[model samples]
Target chain A: MSAERQERIEARIAQLNAEMQKREDYQAIIRLQRAYGFYIDKGYWREASDLFTEDATYEQGVDGVFIGRERIHQVIVKLSGGNPGPGLPFGQLYERFQLQPVITVSDDGQSAFGRWHELAMLGQYGEHAEWGEGVYENRYRKEGGVWKISALHYFPNFVAPYEGGWAVLKPVEGDWRSPELADFPPDAPPTVNYKPFPDQFTVPFHYPHPVTGKAVA
Target chain B: MSEHLLDALEAHLDSIELRIARQASHEAIERLQRSYCYFIDKGLWTAASDLFADDATGEWGQSGVYRGKERIRSYLALRGPEGLGQGELNTHITCQAIITVADDNMSAKARWRSDNMHCTDGTGSWSEGTYENIYVNDGGVWKIASMHYYVTLICDYDKGWIAGDIPMDPPSETLPPDAPPTEVYESLPGAYLPAYHYPNPVTGEQPKKPDLPELPESGEDTLADAVAALSTRVERLEDQRACEKLQRSYGFYVDKAMWNDVSDLFVDDSTLEIGGRGVFLGKKRVLEYMGIGLGPTGPQREQVINHQQFQGIVTVAEDGKTARGRWRAFVIGGSSWAPVNWGDCLYENHYKKVDGVWVMDKLHAPFTMYTLYTDGWHKATTPNTRPESFPPPPDLAPTVVYLTYPNYYCEPFHYPNPVTGKEAPPPNPAAGGVANMADFASEES
Candidate 1:
């Protein structure tokens, strides 16, 4: 073959391999988030936390930022039930669905960001049922050919009783920090504070307009 | 052929083969994960545990960790004997898998979501969670290497999450694990984000805006140029896509009450049967059924009748001429003036390929449940639509008489369990059954 033709073939091969790797990475990332949701649903706190990096940052609602994989793990457990439990007490129901993901991988394929919505059905038997909705702008890193969450920032829109639903929710009064993390304060304060619902707030898009390919203002 | 040409062709073949192998790995892993869920659904602990590798480790929420395949089997069986006894409901509806297979196709990792409906000893609970698992291809069979289920929530069926958050059982004292609780946490009311094991699935880039003429007209100078360009277009049309498109098109047309377009999807001998409305055979009768029974053509003011189709399981036959599908429609119908309602309907429809086009043959929909929007299903439910409930009559009597909500009715399965290959057993009555809500229980009686 001509030298130029050989060069073209080699370039084509490299391109094909790169595309294949990226596709695999995308699928793996989505599965990782979904797996996280499943674990949260069943109160498998430790297993769920294992998916994060050693120095990951965890932030939910206005709970601020909890650093290190261990502290975040403890923070999650504290917020979920308070005690050292791998499961929820009987009668409690937690169904947090991970839906409508908009993920953006970087050029080098080593790091990426994701935007996902969470629809939660949380309640206790015969007492009160609450519905939760939130959006997550999360970051992930590839470690040793496997992906792990590097930073997780969730903006909880509302946690309203299921009776009248979010319609009955009143605007936030004072600090909206979670009570579970009150005693064990986060390593740092929340990056941004905003009230949920009634008082509208867009959690800010992390990607450009899909069709127009323009920055999302 | 020149040696260089042969080399190029060989390289292309090698890449194609590798891609195909990776695709196969994906399929195998997905099936393995789903099969594991199916076995657990029926309390088949042994079957579920066997899907794991001989040296696999198992861990449930706060259960600590069980080492070895034997210990994992014991850990799972802690739920009690297999094939759950009467009045027990252990349903784990797991879906939405994001799987990644190794380049060598030896080991794989996956993330899965599982929705649970568990009822034991007359009490029901709803819970859901995620699974981050490792799988190994052992002797040409994929087995779970490490199974981790992170609990999201488990709430009481009656009270809900806010009021009825349940805690997981602490590490079992009776049957201890090799390791103490690895991670402990509360679910909602308590908040925790499961660390995602995979990175972001997309790119962060926008193409530069094209620098072109501000306004451009049709570049074609003659009609022949435009016609010839149209003929050059290519479409990705296959059997499955064609069938799905045809069925989905029916739903879009029905949403607007477009009787003509909806009827056009069917052929001369096509049949329609919804709920207890009986059969309306032939294309002409199908139009009558929609036009008269479902109102005039096109949407009306202040009315909403959206028959949104979702979760279709389409199966094409070997002959490439006929296909069958099972689909579900979540309907949102009513008017601003009239009362609003929510409904769920199940479909078992048939299609045929005629003259290189797919057409609807038989559309049989059974209304599973319907309720008033204000009251919800727990408080208010509408029964099946009877033959005499509406204006226009049907061509034949209703097929398969069945009850709706307030009275439990298990719809027959179109396909068996994917792993077991056996049809699911009929559903048992929950708690008191029909007698509790019988006519005598009401005030009028």
Candidate 2:
């Protein structure tokens, strides 16, 4: 083969390797997000919190951010009613359906951003049934070949009584965050000011339209 | 020196290409599984069944095992004759697909999360589930070999899963399936763990026995041979990605009622079939059909249309000229003067690469059900009826006649039993496992 041809081949090889690496990075990040969901669904708070980086930040709705892994762990433990002590009771359930994900990994392959719709059904001992919907705009980092949550933000669309549905109910307000649960307060308020259903607002998109390539402004 | 350099370059290129091909295979398989959800949601039995291999096996919801492509078709068809009737809604949205391509690149396994919302007869229900599916690369075209869904929670909209008003195992009054239930499990309130297709993604722990086959050898080859192989592999990956983007673009266009753009995604001879409304053959006719249903182009000021497509499973033919995809759509739509409506459908659609661009060759959607938002599926399940002003009506009558919800029907299957590769035995009336709405109603009363 000619020298020029060999050089061209080398360049193409480099490009292909880069693309492959990007894809693997995407897979790792998605797995990290899903692992977090599975752990939280079963009240495995410690396992869920472990999915984050040491200095990661967590925020939901109006609640301020909880910085650092320990604080994040504390928040989850409080939410799960004081850890429920390893292995949930037979009748307890917290089913969170993380659906409709649009994930974008950074060009450098070191970090990624994702937006997901969350549909949750939760209660203890089959009582106090509640239905909830929300959006998660989260950031993930690749640390030593593994992905972990760098910043987790959840915006509530609605948390309503199961019997009446969103239409007949008022939106649940305030963050679940408390000083008793975590040392750090929320990092900041929600990115946008918008009301839940019965009122309509499009959750800002992180991606352009798949077909038109038009940005959601 | 030049010869040595060439050899090194070829080796590097070959390895890169192999990696790209494996990544592409993972993506294509994930899309293929997602497409199956879309097809099954619409009740497009024929289209959905086609996604399976000739010897595929499937177990969905309460339906027992269905083996073979023909059986799969028959099972899905039972959901509705031609497709869902008007006013019924069936939406099966799937996400969180963790796909693993075998080292050989000839087989794969995937795990997915399925969230289903149904409406029929003025009543609505919600369910959450998981799927562990297998795929085979048959002569370069991937096909589903086995699919099993485990329902985690299924309950009425009003009562919810926590209420305990609904039974864990409602009897199925539909025709007996080809085989008995693979395993007995109950939805929420009764704890049951569905088997996982893979170990923990992060922990790398193998909880269940690994069913993956042995990895194929990386076969010895010359530098020239490797270069040639890598070239072909890269092209295939590019084609797969292009096809995925094309289908996703179609969904976005339809969501905003971008009629011209949607029509442009089809070839001149393409066809569009929505539920029992029948087929709109050719691009001109398809455009006309869209106008009738969606109003005159652009975004209609008074209309609110949200049609979301999820779980796209796409398989490009070995020839690379044509492809088949299964998808699920969750639709919520209404106009200023009309009541809001929500529903779901399954899409078993075809695509062809025309002039280097992928476009829809045939779009077929068979809806499971659609109902008004206020009344839900339980209270006001209305049958689909033909629109009065639409011209060039349905080319054929519905394939089957059935009611949605409060009634039991098994959508036909497209593949045979996964293990047997043989037709399932017909249900025997004397066997006595069939459960119907009446049975549940009486129990609830």
- Superposing all C-alpha atoms, what RMSD in Å does each candidate have to the true structure? 23.5, 22.3
* Tens digit of per-residue lDDT, candidate 1, span B128-195: 66677898987667788998887766767555444556887789988999998667766543434345
lDDT tens digits by residue: candidate 2, B1-445: 2666466555656555665777767756755665565545556566667778898998876678888988888877766775665434455667646566776778988766666656565566766666778999887778889988776556677654444224444323565567867877654544444555543222233223223222223466633444555545555555655565556556555655667667777767888877667677777777787787667675554444545555455657877898876565666555555665655555667888776667788887766446565554434444544534345575555554433322222232222322223333322221112233123222111
Q: Work out the TM-score per prediction.
A: 0.42, 0.42
Residues A119-191 of candidate 2: C-alpha lDDT, one tens digit per residue = 6654443244455676778998888777788998887655655455543544335543333445535545545
lDDT of each: 0.65, 0.60
CAPRI band for model 1: incorrect
Error of 1 at B404 (Å): 20
lDDT of 1 by residue, A100-184 (tens): 4656678899998887766565655445556576778899999888888899999876786645555455678899888867689
- Candidate 1 chain A: 10-residue stretch with minimal lDDT: A208-217
Native-to-model Cα distance after best TM-score fit, residue B336 in candidate 1, in Å: 18
The model with the greatest DockQ is: 2
**Chain B structural similarity (TM-score) per candidate:** 0.50, 0.48
